[model samples]
Target chain A: MSSHQAVREGAKQVVRLLEKFPEEKFKYLVSFKATQLERFSRIAGIPLPKKLATEVPGENKTSINEIKDIVNRTSGPLGLQKDMLRKMQAAIPHDQFTESAMKDQITALSNLVNNKYKNYYDVGDKLYKPAGNPEYYQRIIDDIQGKKKENILAGLRTVFMGR
Target chain B: MLKCTARKSSLNTVTKLYGINAAKTYNYNPVSLYSTTNKNLQADQKKQTELEFDTHGSPIVRGQKSTIPEYKLPKWKEALGEYVIKTFGLDMDKIRAGPVAGSYYYSICKEQGLQYENEPLSDSAKFFYEDLKLPKTFSQWFQITALHEWMLFVRMRAMPFKYGRNYQQKLVDKTFSDIEMRLFDEMNIHSGRIVDQYSKDFNSQLKGAVFAYDVGFYTDDTTLATAVWRNLFGGRKNIDYTHLDAVVKYIRSQLYVMSRMSDREFALGKFKFVPTKEKINKLSAQEEEEMKQKIIKKYEELDKSGLLLPSDKSNLSYDN
Candidate 1:
């Protein structure tokens, strides 16, 4: 299947899993998925889906489903999807999620994902995020391409393990 | 301006026969009388008879020796006594016995270039006259008068006379003739009592005596009379007379002390001075920093307590 088609299918499966989880586990699922997508986006050199960007201000600007599909197609064999599903299932019983904690986690995860994408641009495009300046999409794409082989491997691992 | 006239006396014929001019009778010339033949002959006879006859007289001289007689030195005590008696018409004995005699004699000896013989009165007179350069009687009188006048002047100047009201303004406004008359009147009042008390026989001589007394009291040569005048009249003229008197007395006393001390070389004397070193301890950099920290801690505590006002915060801020 095409990369876009595979990304859409993976997004549908994630939505089904989220609906089945208790409300308290929703934050864990979102954070785990956001983290996994961030890894995928850095490796692929693509903007995050728009739905994910709406969920967090600094995430990739792509639809949520699109980001999920991209992660599933590119990162499924690496096992990030299975790992996040399992963590969500485990967190549901312990009251392991709280609104404030979830916000903190989301913010932290967003920053980490943004930094990873910024790093990709820094290496590949010779497009340094000058000490204080912001990173751009084209520079990120070029950066990811320059390190395409290693990032793809890492991306596969992040998808499978949800690191 | 008193004039005296005297009647001339006519000489008798016997007097004319003696070659005396009758018209000019009173102050007759004795030498002129001797020049007349009759008188000349009598004088010659008297001189020849008085002289001792010398058998081997070398070239007989007819008249007294041509050489002038050695000046007969007058005895100072006698001459001065006579002068005092005649000049002041006072008893010589009284003055000679008085405290001023030494100064009087000293003046005479100085004038004549004579040395004193340790006579107390003569020496004292000489000392006072030469050193102070004032006549004995005059110096004594001057000392008293000067003290009186200085006291009066100081008191008068000191008398807190306000600018518009005092005699000074009046002096400025009045015409010379009017001022003179006013001055005469003031002088009459001012000196009248003094004259009455000191000497009722106030003549030129008495005035001279009073002047001498005044001068004697104020004769400090260092600042001189001009400075005295300036001190007396300069600046605010309306100061309290009593205060001015006290100030003058203080200044005079200070001046006297200064004058006396100025003649001595204190530095070379036993009172030589030395300076001592002073020990100074200063704060080190560490101490300064510690002090700053302590102050900062105090301010922080104050701020935390909310005790500091807005003004305090504004002052505390670095940006301010």
Candidate 2:
């Protein structure tokens, strides 16, 4: 229920209580409740939201698939902590299903999924160098240099094929 | 209506009428139309020798040497003994095509007395295809085949002149014959038309091999990587460089390993490709030497069995 609707209902209950009890003793409790609700309405700098929860959009299962798809495309660049939903799904306990725990799991999965993408954003669209064998590279250099001076030069002793 | 009043004058009549002014000068300029190709040197013989060498063998000089090796080959009778040729030992056109083409007919015949071909010679190498995990895809499969062919080419190049040519010819001949067979049997193509296709493929492959050799043999790993990525990997521009690096390493390791094999081993087709996983570049010198020693020992055992031919190990001075 919305905050306004709940407040209206609570006020009706207080009115009913006042009518039944006919006592000043419970007035302070009612006033204290009003003060608490007022305090909650204003937080640090921003006003606290009393917006009612609409149907929490979609199911986590389909969202999980979408999350996986994003992870596959972006996670290649991230190069770590992959198979997010698969791992999370595997880790979820079958014995118990708690809303808060499920929500926490979702938060953790989202964090894992989003972090790589954010890291990708930080990386920008720059080209990445692949892993290579340094020794092999060196050997290739050595081979070519040797060939250049000896084989190529020797072949070109009589004829000059421009290097 | 137009009438033909103008008489057609012959050259003499025109010249007679116009006198010396109308006469065309017949003075021949001293410049020769054809330039002397060889000039003073007897380069025809040298060219012939080089052609002969190229015809019968892979024209690979030692890594250190630049001089062209002379055209030396096995006796025509010995090399072509089994083939049913009646007249000439070797044809001029065949010789001109180079050793690879000239040896094409003889190379197809299975080596009769060899351990693997005949009754077991006891020293035949047991290289299983499964160990290498050769790629199953057509492009990759061909790449692996190309790798094997290229390896043989390297060995052929490194080989002492006489045997190198023979081996090169045999390998190429086998390749062509195999292609011919594939076309005829598998592809349902007629035998008569196989050679046209074979020649096309053979020339194309040789061209590709030359590039791969230059890139893989002499250049840096990145170049080798690029070459492999182009030829072996189908030039996929989006391919990961790390994968290219891996391919470069694979090529480097193969070249190194192939360089170590004795000509006998290569001739026998006994060299086992280093598995893709075993990075040869990672091995220590001592470890590599130890491995070489083990290979040497295996060959020694084969040598004892009298299977190895004694290739000339001495250097011969040839005037360039």
Candidate 3:
């Protein structure tokens, strides 16, 4: 993807990740090392969502108060810290998210967020032998030329006949 | 009704003299149940089934799972109704055996996707399976399976404790591995990576989606309709609520179809699953009459053969 597209998608991902991330899983982020927290801030390229997480450069020991303050803060327009405000903490630096424990989960989620187009070229990466994924390549060409006639007919049948 | 009674009596005579009607009465082994006896009755039963069970049937409603709790056929209606069900050729027992839930759990993983193209929709309607525009790609195939999986998962939630838990474990495991395998084979993700990455993410999303989606099923119509709109249409501002209304109708239509299916019909994996966004429309009186006539004709062969239930064609309630 172009840098511009990546930036746009990445911003959307951040919003979604905050909205839908597991609350319990993200609680670990509050206990992150001072350096790890800074790394997260750099990646996000923004100040921490809540004011309690003041930027501390290169400090070996970041105060746990940073996370505690944010978690304690109430979400506006509602007395409770619910909705987006609650889950944004999940974006905080947490070792468990990057470790092998959640490694597969990260790749899967990242791929989903990337909306990586399922291309003909990708299939050839692993299945490349003599002809590679030539069959897949041909199928893609057929699909593009025909504009997926098979699916269109399938849709028509489903509509009219309730198949 | 008189016509059905005459056929019922006549069917008994044939049974006593020829032992020909034995199989359908047993409600087992639907395929072998009808080598002869009444060829046209089989066609009639399928058509009637499509209407009574598939078209008009609704979801279990409220807490019922998969099917309504009990049919409670009225005493006066029993003889005729039984005859109708039998004439239609159900053999509910055989359909129940299905493919055997865990027979080849690991091996059955990752269907060739559009695998229905290989089987007929039923013994009749030879053309039904043909030209379904089966999913050509793995992802498209995933969508088909995903729809069924979602429906089944929702139903499982409403099931009784023991069976509900058991079905949930078995179905979820089978579905996930199949999807994981699809990623490995078609998308060519490394097998190792699939377990470490894709499976974990997929599981989380599956849980999130199920929770988000099933709420609509458990709630009232308006909530369900809105949920359907947001999920299916991406909550686009330009799309009208009429489209959502159509979707709600289509969902009820499919659920009605599911409620009507025998266990074998469901578990045997022979149903269609592509999206039907604009497929079904509200029918006019003329069209309604036309549909009724067409369905009625399907049973004519059986009626003429004197196997119809109750007493006759006129006695039957064609539309309730």
lDDT of 3 by residue, B186-219 (tens): 4667668545676776666556445444443433
- Provide the clashing-pair count of each candidate structure: 31, 4, 18
Reference-based lDDT, each prediction: 0.32, 0.39, 0.39
Q: What does candidate 2's lDDT look like per residue over B1-320, in tens digits?
A: 11111111222221111223321432222233234664533433332222111111222222212212354445775445424332333432223224332232223221111111222321111211222222223234335455556655554544444555555566666556555554565455676755576657655865675555454344333334445545655543223323444445455556556555554454444455565555454456698578667766765566467643222111211110
Cα lDDT of model 2 by residue, A69-137, tens digit: 787788452465558656644543242323343333333323322332223212111101101111322
User: Candidate 1 on A1-163: residue-level lDDT in tens?
Assistant: 3654554444343333322222221122234334435544543346666876566653456665666677667645346577877765453323222334333334333333233222221222111121111222223334434643345776686456432
Candidate 3: RMSD to truth: 25.4
| Candidate 3 wrongly placed segments (more than 4 Å) | A1-163, B1-144, B156-161, B229-243, B261-320
| lDDT, model 2 | 0.39
> What is the alpha-carbon lDDT for the whole of candidate 1?
0.32
Best by lDDT: 3
Interface RMSD of 2: 24.1
Q: Which consecutive 10 residues in model 3 chain A have the weakest lDDT in total?
A: A123-132
Report how far off residue B210 is in candidate 1 (Å): 11
What is the Cα-based lDDT of residue B294 in candidate 3? 63
